[model samples]
Target: MAHIIMIHGSWSGGWMWDRVIPILTAAGHSAEAPTLLGADPGGSRFPSRPLTAWADQIAARVREAKGPVVLVGQSRGGLVISEVAERVPERVGYLVYAGAFLLPDGASLGGTIQSAHPGAEPIFSVDTATGMTTVLPEALERIYSKTPVRWIEYARAMQCLEPLAAITTPISVSDERFGSVPRAYIEATEDQVMPLSLQRAMQARLPCNPVFAIESDHVLPSSAPEELARHLVEIANRVDHPARLRRPVL
Candidate 1:
């Protein structure tokens, strides 16, 4: 079984993976889902820190794995994985992006979103004293058509957003490190935050043709856990034995 590390995006924490973790573990794979820094919305004890600091935390998790891990990033966690891969590509076998950011060189989270669709509100807002940005309720409400009541409660619980300044800074990536690593992109067909066209466009930048489409919304793990689990397991199995090709033959 592959060791998988799951990273949550802005305004969310490790709790976001609660539904999927059981599935992965029951299937015999060891899985970890860590909340990013400044994203503990529920009064959890998370040290307020920068994006790079969060990347470092993930790298530490990767280092503790038994073997090379399958790093999975959701939403802005995509940016976290990109940075982690650069730091420890040897420890990462496959980078699985679930409706996450797959940015070009020298792009920040803010810049990437702005470049594609301008005048959008930042994914999060800040707490001046803590310098932590929490997710804006209005944004979440707008993104989800009928977000579960529990999720809204969770959002209320752990609602810190990333600071705009940190989000706008270009993340450092070396082509030498990120170029050779295998990549998988799970594009959400009905995603409101990330347009399908943009996901397709990002595919062009990956090293290999990623798993292109998953019929769901931005919140795949929550909205369609079983279907998402199937795709994730398939990708894990494919990485284990590259010779055993699973892509549908047209």
Candidate 2:
């Protein structure tokens, strides 16, 4: 069994993975879902941190986990996992990107998102003075298109403002570090937030083995929890033999 470290996207906390965590535990894998700095609405106020520092928080968890460690990131959390793998590649057994921004080294999430949809209206409203950002209400429908209405209300109530610095910070990784780790991608096929074409482009730029696809929107955890958990368990089952194929394929 592997210890899975689940990282949530912007405006979301560790609680975002609540739907999928129990299934992973029932499958015999342990899971740790941590809220990134400055993203917890109900917790103590925290100073905004750069993307790398956010990654360091997860890396610290990896150091404490026993057995194999699998790092999974959703949406903006993808950048967090990338940097963690760079800092502690030997400890991380695998990396999973679930409807996430699997950016290449030196890319920032803000830049990638803008480039992905040129001339498109902004999806977020940034408060420059406070250095925080919140999703525009009109864009909510696209983000949670496949999510059930029952969960959508609760999710929006819990959603919090995310730090802008984390989105604008660029990441740097070495081949000997993050590149040495085995990785996989869980494509949300119908994702409008990070559309399928953009997902494919990222995988092409930074290839990972055993690409798996799911027919869900951006928030797969809430919309397709069972399927998400099943894929995660499948990855856990292959922990011992995950690195044999480095090229991503169906």
Candidate 3:
């Protein structure tokens, strides 16, 4: 069974995957959802950290796993997984991007989002003093567009400020390393935070095999946990890790 590492994006913590993890475990796959350095509720207690720190945190997990593990990144966590694969490719069995930023080398999340929604008002307001970016509580409406009211409220309560430095940090990956690892994508079709057009654009550019689409918003954990869990398991079932690859059996 594949051990799935679930990385949360901006303003979110490991708690985001609480609903999804149990289902994954029930299906006989182990899962981990880690809160980024500055994305936890007590995140503000510490100073803002850099992208390498986040990538380092995950790479350690990959190295410590019993075998090569699947890296499943959601939202900005995609970059972290990509960086991890680049650094320790052999330790990574598969890479899965869920409603995430699948940017090429040298692309920063902030720049891509800015470029995508050109001339639009900023979704996050920056705290120049602390290098933190916070979403207006109201913006949860757009980010979790299709989610129920209770989930949104939970998200609002759990969400914290994200580090500006992390989003602005451009990733460095190479074909020989990061590219060698097998990868897939899970598209959140109705995402307002990262629009469907942008999702398709990234898929076209990067081109992951066996792209899976979900009719949900950006926050799939809250909106479509079971569906997301199913797709993840299906993707995990396909990769054999350093051995011959096997196509998913139905």
Candidate 4:
């Protein structure tokens, strides 16, 4: 069974994965969805942290795992997971991007998003006085209309600002170390936040093609946990099955 490290996107804590974790555990896989710094509602009451700090948190988890782990990143969390893979590729079994933001070397997450799709609204808005940033609730309607209403409400309630500047900075991963690890991407067909065209475009940037697609919105793991879990399991099974040198055509 593969050990998995799950990360949630902007304005969300690990709670976002609550629905999906059970499906993975029931299937005999071990997974951990730790809230990012400044994200956990009940954790330490410290000041907000930076993106690399969040990436460092995940790296620590990867280092502590008993064996190689599959890193699952959703939305902005995808950026963090990729950075972790770049830094500690030897400990990572696979890098799974779920409606994730995939960046090239030396690219900042914000800059990459701006370059990839111009005219998109900032996912996080900042308040200079307190140095806190929060995601706008209106954006959720655009991003997660297909998602359950309650889940959206919960996400909005937990919407805290991340250090946007810090998150956008480029990070490094050794090519010799991480280049060969298996990778998977899950496309949310109805995702308005990251459109299907963008999702396909992001998948194209990956070294290998992704293994599955769910015709739901951005919150597929919460909206359709069982289905998402099934796809994840399929990708996990392919760990032993040799990867096809050629990419699969959707």
Instruction: Tell me the tens digit of each residue's lDDT in model 3 across 90-150.
Output: 8887889999998889999989988988876566889888777888866888888999899
Q: Please give me the total number of clashing residue pairs in predicted model 1.
A: 10
- TM values, all candidates: 0.86, 0.94, 0.93, 0.87
Candidate 1 lDDT: 0.73
- Give the alpha carbon lDDT tens digit for every residue of 1-250 in model 2: 8999999998888988999999999999999799887677766555656586688888999999998898999999899898999999889888999999888788999899889897767768999898888888888788889999878887888888877887898878877788888779999999988889999999898887768999998988988999999999888777746554353331
Tens digits of lDDT, candidate 1, 45-70 = 45434667888989999999996588
Report the poorest 10 consecutive residues by lDDT, candidate 4: 241-250
Reference-based lDDT, each prediction: 0.73, 0.86, 0.83, 0.73
Q: Between prediction 1 and prediction 3, which has the larger TM-score?
A: 3
Candidate 2 pairs with clashing backbones: none
What is the per-residue lDDT of model 4 for residues 1-250, given as tens digits with 9 covering 90 to 100? 7787889987677888888888887887788899887767764542344666777888999899875588888888777887887678778777888877766567676676677679887656777875556667667787677778887777777665565555556755555555556678888888877787877776676644555778888777666777888877666555434453233332
Error of 2 at 250 (Å): 18
Model 3 residue-pair collision total: 0
- Model 3 — which ten-residue stretch has the worst lDDT? 241-250
Model 4: residues with Cα > 4 Å off, grouped in runs: 43-49, 240-250
The lDDT leader among the candidates is 2
Model 1 / residue 197 / CA error / Å:
1.7
Pairs with backbone N, CA or C atoms under 3 Å apart (clashes), candidate 3: none
